[model samples]
Target: MQTIVIAGGGVAGLELATRLGRDLGRRNKARIVLVDSAPTHFWKPLLHSVAAGTIDPSHYHVDLARQAIDNHFEFLCGEVVDIDRAGRTLKIRARLPHALGHESVLRYDRLVLSFGSVTNFFGVPGAETHCLSLDGVEQAEAFRRRFLRLCAATSGGAPRVNIVIVGAGPTGVELAADLRHTVDTLVRYRLNSLESPCQVRITIIERGPRLLPTLAPALSEAAARKLRELGIEIRTNTAVSAVTAEHVTTADGEVFPAAIAVWAAGVQGPAINTRLGIALNRNKQVLVDEQLRAVDDPFIHAMGDCSAMQVSDSTAMVPPSAQAARQQAIFLHRLLAGIERAAIPVFRYRDQGTLVSLGEYGAVGMLRQVIGDRYLNVQGAMAKAAYRVGYERYVMANLGPVRMFAQMLVRWARSRWLMPVKWH
Candidate 1:
């Protein structure tokens, strides 16, 4: 049996592994192996909520090892440091903490790269050292701990806590709004005895002309209005030059005091991509063809945020979004499962629209029509319900309907007694 090795057990990687494992591994046709640095898998989109202290991450994370056992695949906990295309092997480095690391080589008949992108600091002085990012679980947990501490200290009669988010994308916008709701929840449920509510201010600085620039103008306006209504400040067309412990300085000499600074501005491919010796785009992402195979080597494939491919008939490349990643994974799975034999169809991305959550303030976004390119703008209660259903669908797909409902019931029960935020 031939071996298939997938690197980075993220959204695309995990899904593809599960599907291929069930189809090929169980049938004894192929050996499926998944490689990732993290022991468990958490949905990347929810990292912002983790940072905001709104939802418990434990409810949704999937154990990669257990999933591998159930799905007839093997899980390896390590980072893919480099790939030897000529040798058909991968160099993986152990990711054990506080210990000497070791490297190992794994051979494979075919390879798939799904390692996600990392936060791009753009060489801004002090930006990397001072600003926090929600790129992974560890970073989100660190931010949440620090945020709770800051709020606690402020409740003890210190100055107000000011959080500055240096981006207007979905992560920054959702995080700002969620932080506002979290502060209110903390005061109402946990710190009600204090004389005053926790004084927390949120400011979003966008270098673009408006927030959510990727979305339609109407949707962007709706999101901006909702954020402002929730008491979040919005500053557009502002370029940050430096970030210090005390403040964020823009190019125009304006400084904003910040107790916590978050950099959600942008993302780029991981540095490891350079070691692959493959053709990379400006963002360091592997350049692939429409079939999601590397232009350099057909045996090596790439997907998710780490790869870039142009649309079938359009000039735009596939955007690095959850939907795009999921689509690519499904596409690859079907192709590998022998669903397409003679002429393999090229991958075409269909925009299902964009949705931004604002915690208790509700949600806003645009939904693409099934028939045509028309998009219907959504807001308030309907949009909020849709936003929630979207996550529930993802959970169901990941954990199966039965397990998903069981977890939901357990979470609901915990909510009856547990506090809204993680205070510790």
Candidate 2:
């Protein structure tokens, strides 16, 4: 039987591992091994919510060992250090307690690389050390701690809190809204006071001319209006030239003092991708063929944010998104299931839609394709409900129905229990 090893254990890698483990491992045709740095998995998209205390990580994370047993796959907790393509082997840095580490080399009959991307700081001065990011659980927790400390220190002193978010992308907007909601709740509980006489100051800085630059201009405008209505300051056509401990210096030389600075400007492929000798695009995303195989190596496959695949003649490459990563996983799974290499179909991306959540009661986006057109624009409460349903559907699809229902129940219970407890 052939042995298949998948690196990352993120959304794409875990899904692939579960499907392949059941289909191939159950039949005794192959062995599937899923490796990741962490022992548990958390959806990357919800890191912002976690940071803002809008969601708890305990209810959202899945233990890799338990998931592996349920899905019929072997789970390994270690970070991949190097890949020897010629030798069909990879080195993993074993994580042992109280020691630097010993290396373990694992050979694979087939390999799938889906080690996902990381936060890209763009080398802005002080951006790395000064600004807070919601890249993973650790960063989110750190941000949450800092947020609590700031609130405690400023209680009854400032009329409002000043939070500056650098980026007008989905993460930034969602985080800003979530943070606003959190502050609102905190104020109602008398946990913190706003610095201003009237309202809390939440600023979103964007280098582009409008918010949600990837979306339609009309949608972006609507989102901006909605955010403003919620007391958020949308600063478009602004670039953060540098970040300091106390303030952010813009390209126009405007300095804004903020209690907290969030960097969600952009992201790029992980450092390991650059060292793999694979062909990467300008953004450092590994370039993959239509079949999702690395351009330079047929035996190795790359997916998720770490990969760039061309979907159409006009479009240069597919955008790094969870939807794209999920589709790529499905396509690769089909190919691995005995479909002839040459006969395997090329990847075609399906743009379902995008939804940017605004606080608890609001969201903006489009949905339902207009026949030949791929884009859809939706707004108001209808859009918000649709977004929630879409997220539930995604959770149900990735995690089985039982686990999904349990998660919902747990969330409801947590909300009831934690709402009255003041962290400060």
Candidate 3:
């Protein structure tokens, strides 16, 4: 049987593993193995909620080992250290200590790299040491703990809790909004006081001229307005020069004293990807052909944030978004299922629109191709509902009906009991 090994259990890797397990593994046509550093899986987009303490991570996370057994695949818990393209083997470091010391070489007929990206600090001094990043589960939990400690220490006083969020992209904006909701909930529970209006201040600093610069101008303006309504201050066309323990300095000679700072400004390809000696773009993303195969190695394929795929002649490369990753996974799955490489279809990215949620009250975005040449410009509750539905559909499509329904029930149960009525 053809042995297929997938590295990373993020969105694309997990979806591909499930598909292959059900189709190939069950039929004994191939052996599918999924390797990841983490023992469980959580949607990356929900990291904001996890950070803000709005959602419990336990309810959302799925054990990789359990999932593999149910889905008919083998799950290996390890961190991939190196790749030998010539031998089609992966050098993985087992998680155990001295008892399970050293590495294990896993050979594969086909290898899929979906290792994902890491937070890009851009070599700014003190930035990595002081700034909190919401890239993974641990980082999010750290932010949550820090926030709670700050709130507890300032109890019975109107404290000026300053939160500085770097980067005005979707993730940064969403986290800022969620934090506002979290603070509001805290005040409602009498954990903090909002009697002094705007006491809990949030500043979103973006290097670009406008927020959500990746989207259309109108959408950016709408998002900015929604954020302002939620009491989030936006600082555009501003660059953070450095970060200290208590303040973030800007290029314009301004220092913002922050009780907590979060860095969501940029991302870079995994470090291991660079060691593979493959062609990479400026962002360090692996350069892949139309079929998502590395130019130098057809046996190796990459998807998600690690792979840079060209979408248009003018556009240099596709943005590393969850949508793009999901689309790539589907394309790769089809290519692997077919025997004739020549007959395999090329990857085509469909512009399905973008959504930026602004707290619970609303969202702002352009629904592309929803009504022909003119996009549907949306804001407020309807827009927020639409955005949530889109995410739910994506999750359901990947996890299938049964798992999706079960997850929904689990969420409902958690909301009813486990979740705190109010969080600071």
Candidate 3 local lDDT, 112-204, one digit each (tens): 999888889998888999999987899999899888777655634656878999999998999988888887777776665444336678999
On residues 371-422, what C-alpha lDDT tens digit does candidate 2 reach at each position? 8766667888788888778767667866789889988898788778787322
- Identify the leading candidate in terms of TM-score: 1
Sorting all predicted structures by lDDT, with the top scorer first, yields 1, 3, 2
What is the lDDT of every predicted structure here? 0.88, 0.82, 0.84
Q: Which ten residues in a row have the lowest lDDT in candidate 2?
A: 191-200
Worst 10 residues of 3 by lDDT: 190-199
- Per-residue CA lDDT of candidate 1, range 331-381, in tens? 888887777564856787888888888887888888888898998889999
Candidate 1: residue 166 lDDT (0-100): 99
Clashing pairs in 1: none
Query: Against the true structure, what is each candidate's TM-score?
Result: 0.95, 0.93, 0.93
